[model samples]
Target chain A: MSDALPGPTLSDEPILRVEDLKVHFPITKGIVIQRKVATVKAVDGVSFTIRRGETLGLVGESGSGKSTTGLAVLRMLTPTAGRIVFEGQDIAPHRGAELLAVRRRMQMVYQDPYGSLNPRMTIRSIVGEPLAVHGLDGDKKATREKVAALIASVGLLPDMADRYPHEFSGGQRQRIGIARSLALEPSLLIADEPVSALDVSIQAQVINLFMDLQERLGLTYLFIAHDLAVVRHISTRIAVMYLGRIVEIADRDDLYRNPLHPYTEALMAAVPVADPEVEARRPRAVISGEVPSALRPPPGCSFHTRCPRAMAVCKTEQPFLRKISPERAVACHLHTS
Target chain B: MTRPLLEVNNLTTRFRTERGTVAAVDGVSFQVAPGETLAIVGESGSGKSVTALSVLRLIPNPPGRIESGEILFDGVNLVKLDDPGIRAVRGNKIAMIFQEPMSSLNPALTVGLQVAEPINVHRGTPWAKAYEAATELIGRVRIADAASRLNSYPHQYSGGMRQRVMIAMALACAPRLIIADEPTTALDVTVQAQILDLLKEVTRETGSSLILITHDLGVVARYADRVAVMYGGRIVEVAPARDLYARPQHPYTLGLMASVPRLDGGGGRRLMPIEGQPPDLASLPPGCSFGPRCRSIIPQCRTERPELIQVADRHAKACFANV
Candidate 1:
């Protein structure tokens, strides 16, 4: 199996590296001059790296901090603390123009097609906005041609550039969004639940488009989604985020085939199978409780409340991400040395 | 054997749009025997929801209408009935669970009141009696601490819980047939399994037929006894669940099965995605709607739309090449 499609070698040098990334929103108290009462830690001390030209899938249920982590990676949200090393430079200290330059290299494709695209803007202008913003508006005709080509590249009609976003369907609008993200030729693309909004049939088309674009343009993708099926289809490596931290990280096949983390095992078991016989045979590991609130997550392991195999140690001591196998890293007392 | 609970014959639903009249459900036909589960599978605009709505005669008349069809429930055609006649049967004889519990359930009303309202309206039972019935119904659907949850509003319940409440509400009257429209689509996986299991169990206990409408083949495989695959407002394939999954005779059904990322098997090859998007319902092609995306489409497929032909005992496919 390895001979047919060799796994991409893991390199020490990563295109984008996030260490202890935290995004916390303050909950205020008074009417006048609000005092910070508590913080909702959307993403807390999460760390992972995306190698050049590799797809890293961030997967979890809603409010698992997967989307927050993706937004933090793009600098769309201000991280309270952490180091974001993009390419070779550290972006934590970068502000204003420096941050703007770094943002140009990292683009985001939002989940909702209806909400993301402006109804007022035509497809051409929507795609061309990034080009115009990046100080590439010198030749309007060439830019328009490029926008049309980008539209075509994402499997949309070239003439769709003239139509308004409302004129197109959900799938077509998503294609426009993809085109807009690619207008600047960004090195890193963070797609946050991009295909979740579309129909199951349309999801395949868009996922294929992502793969084709990645191969054709040598793009690195940090694909964030709750849909494990879609995640397994596109991702090279997968990071399982729970509450506000990554619980597991491994190659896609390795993670799917043999998940070490109990949280991951439960999640995989929960995925519905297409075949009835297989679904009946598949043992379901039902997590007992709902995910704890991020405002005040469980002290040690955020998943301990819902973890089926939660132990006494899982309550008091936080588990660090340690290598369970050569291909997998799991943060659980069960796997800890 | 008992008579089939619900039999829909040549059901056609249409809506008057700003552009023109649109036929959403075009000549669809199927049946759900007592205690059986029938799944109507389709993508967006395939009229799966419309067909379900038409059965209850809930299609808004100003724009939407059941142009032609016979929805026979226990040998009586629901299409021929007046508003009052249909109203008598809607909650008393048949009930429906919508896709989104958050939207379907009345947010202003308490969960108990919402579930009991059907009993109040249909049976003309006292409010207190109906409310007691509602609490009992909640417990029947497996909600923990049903008595406490009865006073809670729909917003207070989580997505899965709200869906359970919806199921509880639908089953409160113990209707002959329960029409569940993508009941589990909005739920997480574990919750989905639980909901599906609950529905299956409750239906079994009551001996009620279920019409499960969803786009997911996976959900159908788990819950459905019979499956109907819809494409461009038409039933492209209809078969038993196991038969359809094993040997999909229609090109559209086969494409849908192949396109989905399987939870079992498949060692890392990229999913074989259907080439093109779904056809524009307003401007459908001359022949088969799936012809554009079908891998093995022949020249004849472009000229004539194939009618469903029986390929096996209970399996049918609407494709010339496969038949």
Candidate 2:
């Protein structure tokens, strides 16, 4: 099933390219007259590219600014700095109708299935609402027919479209969300923790549906998640985030086998394998210390506090993200020439 | 071998919801040997949490009740304990760690006060000594600068730090058994590894058995000595951690393992998800609760519930299938 979709060729231009993106929220004090105390640098200087017909898994723990990066790419949350190039056009400065027009081309699938969908709206109305809002739906009758097909395409029966969000299970509600995202026939889908809220059994179904949809529709996905295993399964390439920085970007297998960044290596070691023998044999290189607050991040490398191999230079001098090979890039002092 | 630290026999818990009484934990049975870590693995609504709550007698009486069962902790029947008897045992002997540390820890009280409160109340230790013990436990859980941080509030601490405080509270009295319900679920992967290691290290030092309730199969593989795979309020399969992983007999167990994408590289393998939704307790199928979703269903599975029987030494399954 995976081989059915063609891999992104070198000649093809990337669908989306993010360059040194930074999203900083000013932490204000005082109720009436707020004064900016400090900036919570959420997505501080991150860069990556998502090719057409490929999955770029962005993974990190909470407060790692992964979700902020996704929202920044979608222009939902305005970037503090850097370029967001979508199909060779920088969409960072766009607003009003231009932004609305750009939104139709790309879509988002949220993490919480229960919270994302409107509880009052029926599945038919919810799915078709996007089409109507984008001025894609022809008429009421045409919208109904299109909604039915969308619902059916997501593995939900067309007849069930009349039911409310509460009537559907978590997995079903997620399918509804997927159907809604696909209503506009978008080229890019930024799915942030799409399967995190599902059961182990149900999560597989949703993932399979995602793969099937990608193969059929040739969709480009920005799959953001915290679970490394889930990310590894669905993503062709992965970017590891730590304290609002892209520490490493490499192919999924390469990242797993030869992680250059200390944070990435620690993350890989931290995730316990399912097999008992494998877990028993593997040496655990568990890193300590909690993630520092984004409000007052560490001086140099944000990961230096917990990194196993932190050099003196890592404590003061910030390391730039540089390509070690053609396909892999890492931001660490040890990898520096 | 040695006597079991805790034995739950045919435990059944029911909840009196608006929809009517439904058995959330139905005829569940398992044993946790002395110093052993037994994981109750299940998805939501599988009654894993209810089973733990039932053991501690923490279930709300109006809406929830332990319908029938014997929770034998250290050879004493916890189910037969009176109000004060259970109280003496609840925090003093069997401590529980919940998922959300923020909610579990008191926001109004200092970390030292809360952790010391249990030690003072249960052991009749002096306030000064209790505070000292609390500080030691805080240090034991690997919280840096434990003395100064003890005066800080829960909100001042991060999520992982709050969880460490929760662990410190759980370890105050050095309870013989610790029930951690999805203890690391709310934390990050790296932080989760640290917390689990701390829990294991502390439990080993105190020689306390642990009842780890979580849905992560990988966690069970690493920490648990034994595992109970629960589905629709019953133990579908129970075995040693290694045995269960090596050869999962129940279809539900097999499906769960297959569905989860492994971190150890199986990118090409397609996940074989179990079909249909989890069983609703209020209106479960007449025969097997998992009958509708069971891929290895037989005619008997639809008509009668299968009893858990010994398939191997220290291994049991509640399925009729030959697999």
lDDT at position B189, candidate 2: 95
Mark the 10 consecutive residues where model 1 chain A has the least summed lDDT: A1-10
Model 1 sits at a Cα RMSD from the real structure of 3.4
TM-score of 1: 0.94
Per-candidate Cα RMSD to the true structure, in Å, reads 3.4, 3.0
lDDT of residue A158 for candidate 1: 78
Q: Which stretches of candidate 2 lie over 4 Å from their true place?
A: A1-10
Q: Compared with the true structure, what per-residue lDDT tens digits does model 2 show for residues A1-337? A: 1111222346987898888898999989999999999989999988888899999999999899999999999999999999999988999989989999998989999999999999899988899988889887778788888889999999998679889999999999999999999999999999999999999999999999999999999999999999999999999899999889988889999999988899999999999999898999998999988898888888888899888899999899888788877678888999888
User: Tens digit of lDDT per residue, candidate 1, span A211-305?
Assistant: 98999999999999888888888888999998888899998988888899998898887777888777768776666556667887888887888
lDDT of each: 0.86, 0.92
Give the CAPRI class of candidate 2.
high
In model 2, residue pairs whose N, Cα or C atoms come closer than 3 Å (at least 3 residues apart or on different chains), thus clashing, are: none
Q: Cα deviation of B206 in candidate 2 (Å)? A: 1.5
Give the C-alpha miss distance for residue B257 in model 2, angstroms. Answer: 0.6
Model 2: how far residue B181 lies from native, Å = 0.5
Candidate topping DockQ = 2
Candidate 1 lDDT by residue in tens digits, B1-323:
46778888888998999878888998888888888899999999999999999999999987998988799999999999988999999877899998799999888999999999999999999999999999899998878899998999988988888988988888878899999998888876767867888888999999999999988877888778999999899999999888888888887787787778875555356666677778777887878878888888899889998888889998888888942
